[model samples]
Target: MLTKNRAASFWNGVRMRTLAASPDPDEPPRMVTVPADWDQDAGAAFAAMAPGTGRASLADASMLWVGPLADHPQASHGLATRLLDLLLRRAAAPLPAVWHGLRGSAPGFVLNLAAFAQPEGGLEIDDFVQACETLAEAMHLLQPSGQTPCSLLLSNLDACLAALGLDYDSDPARAVAACLCALATTAMHPHSVPSRPGASAGSVPPASPVPGLTRFALARWQEAALRGRRSGRSPTHELLPETGPIETGLTAPGHALASWTDALLGVEACGAAPLFSPLRPDGRLAASTLARLAARGMSPEAALAASLAGNPVVAIAGPAATETMHRAITPFLDRAPEAPTEVQAPMRAAAGGGRRELPARRSGFTQKATVGGHAIYLRTGEYEDGRLGELSIAPARGSPVQRGLLEAVSQAVSLGLQHGVPLESYVETFAYARLGPGGAVEGDEAVGSATSTLDYVFRTLAHAYLGRSLPDQPQNAVPAEEPDDALLPLDLPRETHRPSGPRRRHGLRLVG
Candidate 1:
């Protein structure tokens, strides 16, 4: 704690000085240059909003972040000092409507800022607009040939990976890919950075004149994106050329940062959201401070800035450019559920596949159970070793949404079983679940009137797999040896059979 305070005191002062000295560009840079005063403006605003008591407040958090950042390898990318300037400032700012409803941002959930594009503190709309142009130029792939700052950077990274004998396609190599992009965002000057049109360094702008993303703004942005894409048609040289990854020139922190970068980003980095969460997206560092940044630290501005390095990384591109990256990244930013199999598959593939192996299982066992007076078919897949591998539950007849939910639950259960979970664990979770339809069961003697379908299915599984006896329902408790069907008239649909397939699959098409 003492070292943290001292370091915080020192680095906070460093940021104030560095940003204090950098005057805003009066005109566009001869080449792409990060706005000099952005740090100063952001820093000053932070002091106003997240002001610490006495001499300790501002610098304390700054130091808290920088001390560990200074130990990473990417620090040389001009990050620690600038990022300290950005994150501290933005964290002090309010969360946007897009991010307003987050459940929480602790170690559990990966914070995602989707729903709409969010413009955070310390950046001008014009500057942000310019970034969109650059991003769109580099990302749009309308034609086969072109040189975008992004494409060139990718090409350079490709060369680096080849020279280093690293595989660009490898999971470990993704961090390297993302780092290269961050470097380029810094090195490439914005095509044009107009003089200030808003408040100065340290001041907040007036409430937006237009509340939401207006049609005019969207159209202008689209045009800019088109121009950017056209320019990158053949890899223009206007942007500065970077030769390789942070191979040698990095300082110690820069090295550590680089190491973390590799560890953090990858096919798994999509963890910016739920479907693509990594166990430790920010890189599980040995140090407590870095660990906090990785596990507890959540900032959209910082996320954008770190991704961009020179600025911040919010999504952008041509017509599809922004959304594609967003669609790719959205699922990753938010935290996924504790149940691994509960994720949306499309998102996982889009963000990049999960880090852990999701082994496939087919129980080879199909059982019929009744819930809510509706028949449900529970199919289980097991591993060759006889452990449950996967599950599927289809209602004899129901809406797609209903069937989808059942299928999702079964899959989640199957995943748990295959991953070394005991049937008892599942029983503890799902037994007596109280939602959806619940009623008397005509078959499956272990259950009587289930409170919910999940209740009946789970209890049945417990009896069939775990050798545990079913709990007695006061109204219809019967000995295990008795046939539950005896309680019902023989005319009712039997729970033992699947309803005819054609009609079961042909229910309502679109009614909600």
Candidate 2:
């Protein structure tokens, strides 16, 4: 039972319907009172429910009678106070705040702020408490600032921060606040929310967990978010969790697979975070693992991807471990286990008198883009005149199969381009190729998903050097415009003239 903390006199507009513990079909039901204590027996026996403890306890828990704040967002302070009060109560225990939407054993309100997603490795109650505390810290950091994105705490973790449409030095406090508002009354478990007619919102498995929201919280969050958008301040795009449960594996918060990276690859880029796996449900990693990796070196984005999926030699030894390790990158591995060797498959048909050599003093550049939820590492070789000549696209290291194919295409394309093949000629050769768990076009919306990331990066390089823009997309679907400064380019060797020669048979290898 939630008794108002009357000692503090302020506008705490949380009006929850008293719990009516009535199972009898005849007698009128009474309400659970504030300041009332529910011992174990009372908690068990007196209850009216549509189902078990999961659904029944929460069914009549929170029938909010929101006032004008329900329609106004700038009035978020009032709303936030109300919601926070609920969390404070739930965190007190005895009467938990979030009861897993009745989907789990104990029924809880849609507002699950008291509940939190599990982190990498596993979870404990302390983790949930810390997450709420962090949420509180973030909520307080939401003021518009000109100095720094003080609230963008996880900017260095590209996979997690980027998915939320934020980066390091980009304020994500507003977005997190929006997510909290949205998740206030929604179930984290998809199975808990009613899906079919006459069916409970969350009656079975397969429910898509709504991050940071239950049904009611989502409604309040949406209302507040809309008003914020109209006022020309915080927009929905800035507040919501862009990646849903499936995209980020948030449905299973406690589980994530680990892969190992050499840590030496791209030392400059990989040296920021030791463990770069995607964020588990509550945006947490194994603290011990993070400390281990950080002490060693930065894990490059590729290694980050590998850490999530491909097994480190030391970590993988059994099927259970393999499953645990593979869980993170299941979506990225699209190659058939026993597919024919790609490098040799094209050798004969592609070797029509291979080019005598690759360009001397060619410029090499490495840039990374994330597709799906994984990072796609792209390295390019360009001619003296800044014309793109060759490219390599790959997932994280340790996946020999993917790396081999990427190497082949890069070498083949390098040879062909050196032999005078126009870069644009291969545009359609491998454009729109798709494989792996994530082919989502991350940096540039124009380059959508590619037939192969090798193709995607090469195409992207062509546009960058040629001063061309990608084909326009619908206004609504257009992504956050990438700023020029975001691209890091390297000019290898001395400048010279662009190469030209007759296209060679090796160009066949450049073809899809």
Candidate 3:
């Protein structure tokens, strides 16, 4: 297993490489080179399946790198298919490395974003819709034919797609394919199954058919039917249809197909069947499953509590059930609970400005002021006044980092006023006076000369605040009382002499 540090290093390397090789802003992203032996057949197949027109090229690969997959739907679909083929061929290997590389590499994030951005008519965006279809096909092929981890891998892929906000659940066929993959995976790991008595006995009644799906599925079938939908063979049905009678040979005698009906309904009710599972509908947890768990050892309160702990899928199904589950689990949770602590305010303030008020109030521009040899502007307002203001400062042309310090002080003042913090509070909180006058002493020459005084001030202050060494230490720490260097002029050297007049028309005479 890769350690945390190793994984972190690997990710960091991937990021750096990605940034370095990123396509130019005006160009699309190109597929980077993989090992010669790495899924050569799959890559060839992908290249062969490139869309009829608008194929991916090395010059403009970024177009596929970071946006929705649908933006270039055709290409996206082709790529996904190629990747799946490669993955399946290498399923026996430790895949996390390869998966990380593929995901962190170009085209993955870009294509996903593009696909999600254009959900409707995804085919028009890119060939990725076809790729998703291919993925479904691959998933179906893997479940019964391959090893157990295949389903887990499929789950990871589903999670990745969902995280990118793609409509994995939007396509009924694709959803069913994914659910079947998950079921097969779950079957492999019997320990993972939640206990539900009578479910295995097949005594349960078939749940009511979910509404709207029959119409939706029929409409999809019809649309495909109109497309001439590839003649010569009927497409493999990934999951049993919810509306019609199942042809899976699940019937029993005397009850008039009651057992079969119960089996079908049980799958429907538990939302466990590939096509009909409710979890497949929105990618959320099932309420019935939670209820079953509650009937077992789990309590409603405990279930809800578990759901709240980042299991949003569970939370989405039954809030009351989850709550009850949480309550039931509370006693166990209390045995080892987190310690409480005081809430400290956030380090950074909210971005943008505070809420704007109506009938804005104004305060005197200057409450108190004094001038020196080099005068600088300062604004003052009352704390109690019903107005909010901002102060910003930056280096003034030639002024050094010291200018940044002054600006920071100004910002602190404004923040104090807005929060109704007192002057003393500001001084104490910041550990420094807002505005003060001090001179450099002879023994303080280590602070550097006046030319670099600003640098010295910034370095010293930053070190005290950040508890770290500052880059490029200044030679002087003394603040210049008179801002004489506020606008230092540039000096451009003048040429000592001019070039001799053009060659004097002697070329023709010399040739003669």
Per lDDT, the best of the predicted structures is 1
What TM-score fits each model? 0.26, 0.25, 0.19
Looking at candidate 2, the ten consecutive residues that score lowest on lDDT are 253-262
Encode model 1's per-residue lDDT on 261-316: one tens digit a residue: 21111111112111111112122321212222333354544554664563322111
Measure candidate 2: CA RMSD. Answer: 25.1
Off by over 4 Å in 1: 1-363, 443-448, 476-512
Worst 10 residues of 1 by lDDT: 106-115
- Which sections of candidate 3 miss by over 4 Å? 1-129, 137-512
Task: Give the lDDT ranking, best first.
Answer: 1, 2, 3
What overall lDDT goes with each candidate model?
A: 0.35, 0.34, 0.27
Alpha-carbon RMSD, each predicted model: 24.4, 25.1, 25.8
Q: Write the per-residue lDDT of candidate 2 for residues 1-512, one digit (tens) a residue.
A: 22232222122343333345443324454444221333222322224322233323222342221232234454445453444454334321111212112212221121122123233322122343343333322232222232221111111122222223222222242233223322321222112221222223212111112343234344443454345546554321132232122111111101111011111001111111212233222234433334334434545454466645743311101112212222222221111112112232365356664533324334554455665545566656555677766555556432435545665666567556755677776665654444444355675654775544644665576577665555523323433454333232343232244356632222112222
* RMSD (Cα, Å) of model 1: 24.4
